[model samples]
Target chain A: MAAEQGIDPIHQFRIEPIIPIHIGGLDLSFTNSSLFMVIVLGLACALMILGTSGNALVPGKIQSAAEMSYEFVGNMIKQTAGTEGMRFFPFVFALFMFVIFSNIVGLVPYSFAVTSQIVVTFALAILVIAVVIIYGVMRHGTHFLKLFVPSGVSPLLLPFIVLIEVISFVARPISLSVRLFANMLAGHITLKVFGAFVASLLGAGAFAVIAPLPLAMTVILTGFELLVAVLQAYVFAILTCVYLNDAIHPGH
Target chain B: MATTETAGTEAPGAPHEAAFPPFDPGTFSSTLVWLALTFGALYFIMKRVALPRVEGILQTRGDKIRGDLGAAFKMREEANQAAAAYEKTLAEAKAGSQALAQETRTRVKTEQDAKRKALESELNEKLMTAETLIADKKASAMASVGQIANEAASAIVQHITGKPADMTAIAAAIAAAKV
Candidate 1:
């Protein structure tokens, strides 16, 4: 048996630079995260290109898949943000496809998860909030402030309500980013821990007979992680649409 | 010894430090840059190429469906018009045949009336001719009977005492007897 490495489930999230580059004082380098992002982009592009290449009146399998995803995101935006919000269709669609591809690709044996990093998820969340703020300001101007103050409230309770609303509004990006990051981090860690358990048990020879328990758990957790990956991506996109709705309409 | 050795080699930080790299500030800038590049590229491709094509296909399918429905509706209207026209023609034909039958009946009645008038006139002429012939024959027969009566009276007179009796007297007697 190979030497037993410690049950270090956190080792997978490590960022190793593939091509280290230094610009002035900034350490800008290509990484496994970057490579996986490119892979996700390639897969998304290839699926679209090959799927719609025929553009048959009656669609083939891949064409149906491509159309299904397009309509899925389109309907999500329409439901959450209304028709006017469809102006940001490309942005929402891109975010949905990128997150979904990243989550699914990270499930591959040795692939890195770009969404597992807080910087990426936080950046996406900030981008969504930034769009909402910018669009709200542009569209509603001074009336956008009404989103912070609920209607039908007395002057005495108004201040407290506004404070709570402000706190929740500011916490949108934090919650959005953390929700996805924590889910992926916890799921990957659990899978790795179970996998390490199986490895260690097998290495012990006599306990190898019990390795199937942790192995079975790893398998089940893997299935669960796959579900989480899809669900988290969908949740992220839906939240983005909901946030964007406030910008489009401004008031309640 | 094995646990310590594995821990030392695998993780350089404390046990908690190695678990979460997202809090690490050193790699944040690089990760952000890459994330921006990748997400920007994905957004551009989706907006410019991938999404447009899908939208185009959907638009074309929608247009085709609408056009087919319109064509079908138009064809139905045309069929309805043709059916109306056929019904109109059939009604006209029935009306024309009814008028022709009425004309034939009137013409036949007129001809029969003219023929019946001509036959009655001809039969009246024949009856007049037969009555005139019978009158003429009765007059001639009475004249002959007068002459025969005159001759028989003369013979009887001769056979008796006197030679011949007067014919006028015998005719007068015959005339009186006919009356």
Candidate 2:
């Protein structure tokens, strides 16, 4: 009966291992999150292949679209991260593509939301943060630790300032993960609820002829979801750029 | 944060655990596995092929442009040098032509002056020879006139006396006639 209502949008957030395998007492089985991630990757690849296969100077529709997306993310990285930040562009671009692909794929029937899962999102966020820290430390040595110290602070206030900075710094992964997951989860849930409303209304026959309103709402919500998918990806990339800036320049 | 926390508390079950419908997690797992594979392959293609080709093309274009510019500069330099050399040769030719013309003019003037002097000296010698010939002719004529006068006086004496006159008288008559 619950399945007939279609997978509950809220229930879609649940993480369950596909394989019952346990390795060293840890269940490393493939999860629903992993499945959506694969779909997202496939979509990204197919899109990229279609885009670049023409290799036409005067690009066709697909190529132009791909080039546009690349330029868009590339410009954003350049603007926020500066020229030095260009080194991280590929990773950022990939990250954005993956998030966007996943979100859109999640809109498909019977698909799981990869971003809705905390573990996956958290893993990605941690990877970014780890890279920033490792790269920063390697590049700047002990000076990387100097990121906490503000230049103009009073000596008495320096301690409090450093503490606040440390807390913010530690909160990076949390914020990054939460932002993606929350946005995906909320958007999907809203889309589902609207979809459910239309389905329920249409079941009422002539009495619920107004069911088309919910259907229209669903279409509108779907469009909004697509927008959110793209927006979330952009936001994620920009945040990464900002974080990279911090890593490169530190306190400033 | 409180709103999120409250919402989270209300939505705490694995949406798949509901038994009325068997929630297949395999689909999700399969999708994820394929996504990872695709992502890996695409990333590889980008790193290995597309990016390198684009970079190569850009580099080739840059090199071609630079090479063309270098060639143009070299050509321009060569043309300039050729023009300079041509101008120098032209100047030399002009100088040579002018020198030749000047030398020819001077030689011609010298030759004309020598010819004019020779002509003038020859003309002066011809005038002296003509004057000498006229003087000799005049002297000879005077002598001839004296002799002719003597003959005529003798003839006149003969007619008057019907006898031949003596040499001393004749000479005296001739001398008087001559006076």
Which one is best on lDDT?
Answer: 1
Write model 2 residue lDDT over A1-252, tens digit each, in one string.
226546365665655567554334333356666556666766776666656676664567866666666678778988987889878766777777778887788777668777776545665677678778987998899888889998988999999999999999999989998998888878878877877777777777884788888779878888888888888878888898899887888767
DockQ for candidate 1, C-alpha atoms:
0.25
Candidate 2 residue-wise lDDT, B1-179, digit = tens: 11121122222233345432123332333333334454555557655654444444445656878999999999999999999999999999999999999999999999999999999999989988988898898889878876776676667778898877565777777678667
Off by over 4 Å in 2: A1-7, A14-26, A30-32, A205-207, B1-45, B53-179
Q: DockQ for every model, please.
A: 0.25, 0.06
Per-chain TM-score of chain A in candidate 2 equals 0.89
Tell the DockQ for candidate 2: 0.06
What lDDT would candidate 1 get against the real structure? 0.84
CA lDDT, candidate 2, residue B99: 100
lDDT of residue A36 for candidate 1: 90
Model 2 earns a TM-score of 0.62
Model 1, range B1-179, lDDT digits (tens) per residue?
A: 11111112222232244446666656665666677778888899999999999999999999999999999999999999999999999999999999999999999998998998899889889989988898899989977977787787778867895656777777788789778
TM-score of predicted model 1? 0.76
